[model samples]
Target: RRKAGWVKERLDWFEQMSQLAVDREYVSGETFLYLGRQYRLKIVYGSKRSPVKLRGKFFEVNLSQSMPEQDRREAVRRAMWRWYRAHAWEKIRKIVEHYSARLGIEPPEFRIKYQAKRWGSCSQGSVLNINLRIIMAPLSQIEYVVAHELCHLKYKDHSAAFWDLLRLVMPNYEVRKENLRRSGWQYLL
Candidate 1:
């Protein structure tokens, strides 16, 4: 009877703690909501307290305390997208110029936008369209995407030659590509 009572008491305590955790709101100022137990603001993770600043090379996350009335977390996410558009364009342009010269091909027009399923795309006209969300990724991942698209200028399809070209520029292209795929969804939220 004593052991049973102890188990029941422990179960009740656990339930109460779980409910408290669920009710806790991690709102910070007016721009961000700190999700998860820990508080951190990186290019990949969005939070209410994240400083409205861009990190190294790639990755921009919004840290705002006000404006949108929606979930504070969503507001921070939207701000991150805006930051990406405003800042990432120039960096991408420079990368395209560098790769185009190396490949000896006319540089294609580049555009960045919010894309759902793709990190980047190359049209028949050789115009390269990259997802602005990539601005939230690591710089190496961004470079991998750029190199992948640039290779398309040589081979329209993902042929063996295409992989070879990508490898020539980025020896660890495969690893970076996998990382991008695995963590890309973190930016979406």
Candidate 2:
């Protein structure tokens, strides 16, 4: 009975949170996330070759002025994806390097890809695959995911030993994990 009450409360909270980011259309004035900060989208008429640039507090996307309204939205979306993927790799690479040294393991090869349901995963072969969207999350959350995966190099499964190692490195990992869970919807875009 206690478990059922907790589940009901969690479900209600999710329902309320989902209403926060209902706008999926990539248009000017709509907000996007980067490193846990919100940046408003700014569509501009300019070169299609260089589509996206993060300037100050806005993600400015360049598209042809003559393009139809529908196409402009898509162009902005694609530009944002490209920019995010590039930045994710750059940031994650450095984080992995930093944590790998602290953990006493060589930085394993890593890739940033679009993952619909996972923040990160470590394979038996020691490769780290990070979701590109996770780049939108705060740096602490990203560090937690990287450290968690790197720890898997020592322990393949989520056994007690594995968690002990993770806790040793990231003392406040549980707090970061809960924050990620509560704010995940904001990063869906």
Candidate 3:
């Protein structure tokens, strides 16, 4: 009975993952997030290699009409990755600089990471790793994560002092933490 239950649970988890993958399939007019704002995709068939740009309220995708449907999807995916990576690099660096001096800790070596369990982590070597998906989050939430990880530089563990430091840096950190936990499901894609 225990073995059967375990197998059933595994199957259910796989099914949910598959469903989420399908749901994330990109299509024209579908909304995608950036800095907590949703921009609807506008596919405009065109001739350039550069295919994605944020124009006003729309994330316009310029593509070649001759491209196959499958190829177009792949192009969009690649374009999105490029967009996220470029923005994340700039945003994360600025946040680290802003908080490092305020917290009285030298800024750690920050880099983008694709970790499954954490939005950010601080290493013993003073290196900070931020999950790239966080680029999609609101600026406040991104600051909260950066503050929380920087706090770890002073306090290695999630001790009371760590929370105190986090609170000092971000007064409403608890709210951001809670919101981050709830919205994390969306980043699985």
Candidate 4:
């Protein structure tokens, strides 16, 4: 009976420890997986480690030196966002210019941001806002997004005419749209 009680106590302690491990929030010096990369968190200032790495199936992030967990996460996110913004802008600009000239339309001013729920949006004044996260998406999908917003310049609503305009630019817009919807979460991460 005593042995049984001791075993139960040990099991309870083990369960508690497991729960703690599962519940612990972000911590410096801990390793975690993101985007199929394994990142080691280091808490040293002026360290030479890059913020993120694209391993075979995961992404690794190196915590900023002497940074708090939340701050470190924010820093990593900012770095990723910056990189995406530059790449996406370059790609989108080329596409926009190509299509704009072909359609004989004035190009809208473009802006990139970290939007939570929108891939892109166009204003009444013809300014286009694209999510920076779109950079991480496939190139074809990004092109589709740009074309979709450009269509709005002619047809502001999602009417059939808007879709027709989109089709004029991207015959496979639907397929690209579906692809973006399916893999959009990858960018958010």
The numbered model that scores best in lDDT is: 2
> Each model's number of backbone clashes?
7, 0, 0, 8
- Model 4 TM-score, 2 decimals: 0.64
Q: State TM-scores per candidate.
A: 0.61, 0.91, 0.82, 0.64
lDDT of 3: 0.82
Please list all clashing residue pairs in model 1, or write none if there are none: 30-65, 30-66, 31-64, 31-65, 31-66, 32-48, 33-48
lDDT of 4 by residue, 1-189 (tens): 859987996787566545544432333545443322345443334547665544444344555456765576567656555545666678888988977875679887999887877989998889999887676677788888889888888889999999988888889999999887765654543
The RMSD of every model to the true structure, in order and in angstroms, is: 12.2, 2.0, 5.0, 12.6
User: Which candidate model has the greater TM-score, 2 or 3?
Assistant: 2
TM-score of decoy 3: 0.82
lDDT of 3 by residue, 84-157 (tens): 88888999999998999889877789989778678999887889999998988889889998988999889999
**Stretch of 10 with least lDDT, candidate 3:** 16-25
lDDT of each: 0.66, 0.88, 0.82, 0.70
**Candidate 2 lDDT tens digits, 136-155:** 99999999889999999999
Off by over 4 Å in 1: 1-79
Question: Candidate 2 regions off by >4 Å?
Answer: 16-23, 47-49
Alpha-carbon deviation at 173 in model 3, angstroms: 0.9
Rank by TM-score (best first): 2, 3, 4, 1
Residue 158 CA displacement from its true place in model 1, Å:
0.7
Tell me model 1's lDDT, rounded to 2 decimals.
0.66
Compare candidates 3 and 4 on TM-score and give the better one. Answer: 3
The all-Cα superposition gives candidate 4 an RMSD in Å to the true structure of 12.6
lDDT of 4 at 74: 62
Q: What is the lDDT of residue 20 in candidate 2?
A: 71
Which of 1 and 4 is ahead in TM-score?
4
